[model samples]
Target: MTSSSTQHRPPIGIITTLRSSLPFLFFLLLLLYLISTSKLLIYPPHITTKITCQDSNLTTTNNHPKTGYDTELKHIAFCIAASSKLWKSRKEYIKLWWRPGETRGAVWLDNQVKIKKNETLPDIHISQDTSRFPYTNRQGHRSAIRISRIVSEALRLESDDVRWFVMGDDDTVFVVENVVRVLNKYNHNQFYYIGSSSESHFQNIFFSYSMAYGGGGFAISYPLVKELAKMQDRCIKRYPGLYGSDDRMQACMAELNVPLTKEPGFHQNDVYGNLLGLLSGHPVTPLVSLHHFDVIDPIFPGMKRVESIKHLLESTKYDSGSLIQQSICYDMKREWSVLVSWGFAIQIMRGILSPRELEIPSRTFINWYKVLDFTAYAFNTRPVTGHPCQKPFVFYINSTRYDELRGQIIGIYTVHRERHPRCRWKMESPEKIHTVVVLKQEDPDRWLRAPRKDCCRVLPSRKEGIMYLWVGHCGENEVIEV
Candidate 1:
């Protein structure tokens, strides 16, 4: 009887133990599911990856080791106008013919113009006389044609040694530091000409328009100059009666499939006028030259053009020392001010939404929320309303996750509409009220909305609702309890 009683008791005890452990097992499984689904817990610090060449040999090499031109490679060649017409008075037509250095051009070619320590100045040559050309009435076109001829002669003179020939208007102001920097980037063996390239436009009916180089500035590589010299006669025959010689020259290069690279911060439009502020802040450090078209002013009588060049050369001594330094400081201050304003706005927005914890999946923590926060912070301080994806406040979340979170009200914060004038306010649901936990009294006011008696409600059957939260103001009047 005792043995039978013991067996029944053991079975009953085992059954009781299994029933007690069921609740604990169920709770453990639920916690595991929540941990698996939360994106915020899984990913952090989402970073974009960029591809770069891995070869050690791909690194940039410095070519310009010495101050001046390498004797082995003659690079610089001067193209001076041999027979240029000079006006006697302010309103007068050409009264006398002079060489490049005889009038204002002479001031630029003076002893003060020295080549860099290691850099070499090429053989100088003059352009052919314009009297031989059929188009004598158009002085602008004639000058451009003469410059082209000079470029041809320079290429021919030092055919083997030189790689580039620089042609400039007599009144142009050049910064040698800028030119040397560009020359240093390439191995003297490679050939590439640098200049501005723009699509052609037709402004007047009298002229048939086509793509051309801007008249103010340009630089040609040694190979390009050589090719142009070889094709000079053919270009003249192919494009007969071309309106602008510079345009025609560019067209010739285009026909040869020679691509032009742009060198920014090298040339200035004002030859005599000082550009203390503009060149200093440009991303490109070195500037090549300045093209001052109106250095000889038609407005002021008795203003000798050579006198202006001399004054400008003297002014350079003062500007070179302090002008760039001051401009850089000013630019830094402006950029810092912009960053500070943006940081302040981000702090305010974060403070307003402090009550809510972002409930994202662990996998999405780094990729989605972090990116959104960064974007929102950047755009909030801008003067104008930023584009949706471009601004800091707006972030791209997975559409599926967004859809799940759409109806859920997570925090109380202010919303402002900047660009749109006539925005309509509509309550989506009358039955469902959203509870906004405010930390301060003035938070809702900053958002430009009136206070309400009850916390905002979401209508049970309705699909959408808009609600805002106030910080510190916990009063019945301040709370919108819908």
Candidate 2:
């Protein structure tokens, strides 16, 4: 009976079998649809489907370092304010510092400049549009009135991809790398009014402390630029009394409720003196911009302005932080006190320690910089004693120009000290050291060394730390601190 029932069971309807299996077949088709639409099994998927942890396309205004933002992926636009009268004086500086595509914004002026083929003059000429804003007698006032229009035009002409819009004067020299670094430090998605004060406290007082010196240059984020473009004209109309472009900018920023994000690297250079005190004391930060070189002295004591700038570029290129770190000026105390200024150290006490008493040879003299003092009563670090009387005491001079030789000589006097075993420690007259300067021309990455000759002598290597013989033309000026 079981065999007969089994034989007859499946000879039953195909419709019945199909109906029973429909649910599983339907589930399989649904799974396939989901896989195709969701791209689950696809190899080499599109960007949205790929596992991406970072947005490599970062902008200056949208970057947040903690959020994996990179402004290097973006570009910056520069808006420069210049008068037709001062074009001659400022053209060289523009050529020296400004890059074509980076500084692509217009240079607001009354006339057109004769630009050479490779030379990058301002991208646009902002001639006096008397219809927009009438020309005025006060040049400063005129520039103040023109700023809003200039900024508006720059915002319009620059590619939407531009992340930061910087406003500067004809004299402003931008260290674009440092500027980018500073800008990258903050989340540019938020409004940023970044700049530094003038060198003179009085200048800052005359203007508002909140104001960004036009010469030093200031940066505005793309979002801020859009906001500024909207209100800039109205803001300028409100500040009719403001004479300087910087003051007007400050007034507008205040109206916008955007405070100055003071960046010390943006030097206005309104005051004249050696910058050694400031640069040496603070070496960690980058120097983004420097302005008013015509009024201020060349960075180094004797360097010409152009030479000083070239040296600064070369020094920074060679070692970005070393220029500031190595341009040290400090005083160390011992029985023989030493004053070190701008890489130079001088022994202040004549008879502090007798080399003969210490049993060192007289003819084999030592420069005091070679010595280190670790006695309970003495400062831990000082220059080691080294022979200074040797012929052709070779120094590798990395100067941009010839005028720097005098400064280097003066710098030598500031830190020069000698010790001799045969001599009594007397204040009378230290032995004369004949020094020769050798210019550095080889690769900056390599160690600087003078060609050896029987007539040429070099300082002995110190056990503590060897003093670097190569000095760049742009080294900080001598700053003697007690």
Candidate 3:
């Protein structure tokens, strides 16, 4: 009964099986090693059809340039986001800044806008449909997803020789030359998200401090825009809960690891009422853009909103670098503190005010959050001087021109109001000075170097009713003093 030798062979000893097949195992391992090293022609794995991963480096440019680079209007592509219905009225604001045959980019509307023939504006383009993009924000419109795509859209439209892609709302007003100046400071070949946050403290807190409010406008370097375009749609898909375009763009910026390169010049104007106080105390930076014209009083006190913006542009043309530049000087003999917001407004206070105190904005404009909530403003704001004696004698620009003969800029600012309360403590009142003649030497290169508030000196004038003031670079040791 040798049942076929019941040969289990003692179930092959653990090490014996390996020892017996050592050569085969070694051969198999060797084959695998060779295959891994590509030394053997192995069978190809099945070619799976899948979505291609984005090549981030495809559009990345050299962050640093070796040669001199100057950014110009031609180098920037502006993508203005607007509601199709609002385009008619808002185009006036855009026309104030957009120079036809010079400026590039388009106005991205949610739908086609009925632009008039020969309208002085950028090309109007209906924005690509964004209905497929999920937007779960309970309070915000889905247009946010559309507006957030503007930079990417503009990038695709004008990729060649474009250094920056500037984005804003149709109501946004840009000092285009100054926009060039600000963009020039950074290497556009690098990843840069340049703009200021919302003027409203609550708006910034609600959205993000790093976001560049779209109403105010923001600039994205060409390289950054290209990279953003690569993933913007996907990025928007991920951020379905964002409240606005700026926040969504900011979210994508976060993904790209780029922080907001804040240029305080961009004004979100997240406030209401007169903008006089805000513009008067502007920071000593180029005034690149102004937004929220639809919500606030005209920048200049006495003119229509569009006309006022154009008047400001009139001054900007002669000296965009110095426009809204706050140059504080004093008529010490008269005991008056004169603040010449060059190309903007003039504020004459009855008493000597230290520059430190006057630099903070006066709360003339209504805060977006709450008029009474002093904490609602993003920056410091002193309450409007209810005391007539301490209040400023306001003046707005009447006209501006490049005095070709003098090779400088001449700005005329007249009293915004007819009369004011009599100041008891005044050495000599500004009331007699019917007009302020501001003469500024054209220093196109002013912002090219370091930035400081230009100095204003009250110059003698033979005319009885007019006061003459000169604004320019202060002397080596000059300081704004009382």
Candidate 4:
């Protein structure tokens, strides 16, 4: 009976075995697919959500276009020097007097004037008495507060109707258009104060949200001013001194949980060098204001204003044949010559090197190309190759003493494409092959040749190698040996 049983049963049929294993095979495939698709399994981390105010009570209608001047809610007031002496001594005198003849005529003045069609110019009272006060130390703060009060009085019909009060300095070159545009974009009604905030600690006492425009250009909504005026007793009790008036105001608003929207490019510190560029020539057209601190002397204001106006007119005019044209032509020719010279130099270097010596080491080649790519990316322009007269390529030899060949293999080569055709490639093929030269590590002046046929090699496992080969762009036909 044992002998009969011992006769081995025929091996399980292949079809039967496959049928029995099918479910397991399917389960394994399904699991692999899930694993491949599950990014959470590979990388699990928490994401933080950013929060901000979403209350609608803070909305403002100050920025909207006026269908009728009466419909507008905000009014701007300038704290001009009241007395003739104050006006004569003010830094804004220059701007107000600049091109006096041009603006003196009623017709020209009307065209140049920016008053809205139906909107009357809010009465701008000159406060001679206030200007004479010895509040020069807190002059800016005093001026802002006075302007705020004046604005509050100007739109008195509706105590709750007013939404924003913009107070600016006399010398400041204000841009009403940009002020309106920005206020509209940000919806100024949502915040109580909007200005340029600075984080500098010394000035932090001025305001945690120190308006970068200093105390010169800022917008205070009616609600905030009302709240401050109502809580004047508490605010004064909390912050008793005038030393940090701006700071006190900001602190009070913060206590009320009022947010301040910081608007950049709206205010210019009168002395900033890029003032012309920042203001885009028409400071009054797009910017909120220029502090004019640099023009503290009354005469300089007029001079600066004249210069600004002249520059603006020139910028607007078309030059048919002027120095500008000649300069442009000369620049173009010089640049072209430089580029041609560079190309010739690169060609000469390429001709001097043997094919094997021209091949750069992998790391060195990658680094060099990376430099070129970085420059191109930064400038948003093409790489410039070297010219014949200019040495774009530089060599750096290893000087460290730790290794025997420490001073042996290091060198730097720069390829300025603008001057050298050999160094340049088609704009579309920014990553293509280009000429490279090597020099003695110790004596960079001495040129050396590379020994490889190609500067870089395709790694066997790299997808780039396979794809490039498939596209027939790879030089080597054989598969890379791992």
Candidate 5:
């Protein structure tokens, strides 16, 4: 009789069931969040483990004040990746230049490098996992795969002891002291990925603008390193078509929502030319590392690449000061102008220049009220070692007349020098006169009035197939190569 009266119960609505469980779900998630943030301590008491080097010579400094902050608390591990092809030169260079006494490092190899049994190297060895990638040996794609494996291995080693994981090519030069100093600026407890772009915009276009060009080397904080190691194998597998370790690393970072934090001290040297064009002007930042010495000459003046590097190391020994004062100057063939009051060279492109003066000492000192595209422009400073311009040439284009000379190359050079230089103003037009003046010791009128003067002519138009920034009217030799 009860069965006859049995009625089908109304089906429970999904929304109603979800709503009923919401409180419990929320509480669970909140607990996880708290634990993840280390707010709710569920784990056992953490032991403050001190990192000790296996070698007595390797002393890990925990805190040093002169670096402007405490950095000894963190340990930096370097993973210098190398190919067997470059084994001889790179291994020797590492032994000669790289000082691993303060930090931990290892050389990752794709193949075994033959070295004398007595010869001590930075524990150089190839990846034990011979699982071959689709990419051929020495190809950048394969290099990227190897780097992922290297990073995975590095993370597995003494997890708590490693605060930072640095990756560099065999040719890369690391100023460990400066690297430590720069790392000190950021909290090691947080996730950080530091690097810079290649000097070549084309390479960036082909690969990725966000990537820290591998040549300049890069650093990953311990927290980020752990996160990366988890997904690295999967990430590498996905980027089968990508090239360059840096580019692939960037792609993986994108998936993890990590951005490249640019540090100017890391020189990609993607551009072709003497670095004098770059390093000369007093760079305000400290020089942390320089890469691609294989392509260009070394940074230090007047020595072979290796010797120059050694010389640089000696000069900055125990010194945490900035490499340059931000007065660095480089040459460009593009249209340029000078700011009279403030010492700056304004390169004229499609963008308009700000009429006002920005700052003295160097452009790096003052924030640009308006972007004038001044990096390519040259100031009074000479990056060239021998010809150090004591009283550098400075000039200004009339901003009111900027429209008239929008795309014209302007060159300024030291004609002759006096201890206390006088600024010279030359008016080229009446409505908005184009002006030129020296920066440092200024008496503009006196120099213009002087019959005998150093002459520079930035022609209004290009001649034949070539354009010239004529400095002293003496044929091609006097022509300043933009």
Candidate 6:
């Protein structure tokens, strides 16, 4: 009976049977392909690769060994990018901040750098070859590819107990204590990119508004760098035409979907000429890293670039938290607007000015683009004008010391050059005042709380041709009024 039925059914046609099973076959093949592809792609540094579960014991900001403690010198690993040819001159800048054995990080050079005798610089390490990474930027050097890899390369070294990895150029002078203070705000256990953009408006427009200028330096949290190291090369390859390591690093950050957590304290200093205006009116934040020391004029008017930075560092030593911090007070009797940039300069505006006007930086320096127009600046700038009401007589810091017995920092700023300013108002000229003295108490944890400008009180001058001010937190009822 089965033979007869089979004969009547006329042996199922092979073509018809194949059609019914094609859908299942296609589904099976697609699933297999995806599994194989994922297996191969998982090991390579893809932008989206998640390595969290791969290393369960990996330390995070919250789980870091010293998580509860504030960030310190040892917790940060700095990767300084330098060319072997330029290392000789740049080492001086490094020597300014790199505390041997205490500061963690390395100076990455292109070739073997001959360490000078008694050179107390960070350990010099040659960068891994980056010729394999393609770069077609007409205006930028190919070495940017190598420099961009510094963060990943640094991570590969597996520095111990590192909560964050900080990157900077060899010429970048870091206010390390201040940097630690600023970084202490964010959680290093999470993916955080801490830095600021360039001072040049054109520069930001040309590269990115969010890209952290590598010269000024940027900090990457341990968790982010661990992830970044996994896929940075491939991420770099995806953008060969990018200008510098900064934009390349930024490109990777873009893929990670982590936006720049801008800390204004990280100054790119993308300007040339006198840094007086810039430093004197620095945003009411801690001064972190100062970049482009090689390009701009010496920070201190009369000193060499190195000497100027060291000079500024002198004030940093006494009260790093208050270094270049703008504290405004009025010389009511003299009818003068006083701006005390503690440890930097004390600008005595000839006429009483609103604190708002003092807050805007003087455009004493030129933009990086060399554009003469005011629009080139990333920030608002008050022209260094002849108007007595707006003109500032900046007295650069001549000497600063910690008065241990007084529990305060005594800073004396002397006129670099006495100026004869025009003011028909018959107001007593600040030019008559030869020196400005500021006493700032050491507030070791000033940055731990929300950042706000410190208040300054104009105390009576003990001697003629002198002015004294006590700089500290604003009183509940106190206000900087003209």
Q: Pick the candidate with the highest lDDT.
A: 6
TM-score to true structure, per model: 0.39, 0.57, 0.83, 0.37, 0.54, 0.83
lDDT of 1 by residue, 1-482 (tens): 56686556667778899789899989999999877545222111121121122334322224322433342212544343322232112111111112123212111121123223432222223444544555433424545455555667655455645656655544444543334445545554545556542211111123322222333345676777777788875665565456665566666777778666666434433212322212222221333454543542421123355443333333223222111111100012111100001000111111111111111101111111223232321011112223232121211110111112222212222222223232232312111212211111111111112221112111111112222121122233332211
- After superposition, the stretches of candidate 2 with alpha carbons farther than 4 Å from their true spots are 1-68, 100-104, 127-140, 273-284, 321-466, 469-482
- Model 1 ranges off by over 4 Å: 1-74, 81-83, 87-126, 129-140, 197-216, 268-283, 293-482
lDDT string, candidate 5, 1-482, tens digits: 35552474446696689889999999999999877545111111221121121333221233312333355524888888888898887775576446545557788888876778866557775775635555543445455677656766877764767878888888888767668766777777788889777655456667777888777888898899888888887887777777767777888899999999988677676644445435534234556677777766554334587776665455343223323212211223332332221222222111112222111223221111223334433233222112222223332211111111222112222212113233232312111212332112111121112122122343332222222232221222332232
| Model 2 Cα lDDT, one tens digit per residue, 1-482 | 56786567664487688889999999999999887654211111221121211323322222433332367524678888887788877877777766665555667786776666766676657644634644344545565676556767787788667888888888887767667667876777889999977645456666777888888888888888899889887777776667777787788889999999988778776544444333333323466787777865565545687767655665444333223322211113212221122221122233334321221111121112222122211111122345332111112223322223222221222122323455443333323323322122112211112211011112222212122223332222322233
After superposing candidate 5 on the true structure, give the runs of residues whose Cα lies further than 4 Å from its correct spot: 1-69, 117-120, 130-132, 136-141, 300-302, 326-482
Which scores higher on lDDT, 4 or 5?
A: 5
Q: Model 1: how far is 80 from its true place, Å?
A: 3.5
Q: For residues 401-435, write the lDDT of model 6, one tens digit per residue.
A: 77555466677788878455566777777767777
What do the candidate models score in CA lDDT, each in turn? 0.33, 0.52, 0.80, 0.32, 0.52, 0.81
lDDT (C-alpha) at residue 335 in model 5:
22
lDDT of 3 by residue, 1-482 (tens): 35564654455586688799999999999999877544111111221121121323221123423323677889998988989878778888888888889999988888876667887888878788889999998999998888898788777679788898889899998888888888888888789999998888988888889888888889998888889989888888998988989999999999989999999999888898988788888987888898888888877766799998888888766777888888888887778889888877898888888888888888888788656787898899888987768778878888887655546666888887756766676367777776887777676776655566777887655566577777776766666754
Report the Cα lDDT for residue 117, model 6.
78
Local lDDT at 91 for model 5: 70
Better of 1 and 2 by TM-score: 2
- In terms of lDDT, model 6 sits at 0.81
Better of 4 and 6 by TM-score: 6
Candidate 4: tens digits of C-alpha lDDT, residues 5-75: 44855466976898899999999999998885542211112211211123343222354333323212133
State how far residue 341 of model 6 sits from its true place (Å): 0.5
Worst 10 residues of 4 by lDDT: 320-329
Candidate 2 similarity to native, TM-score: 0.57
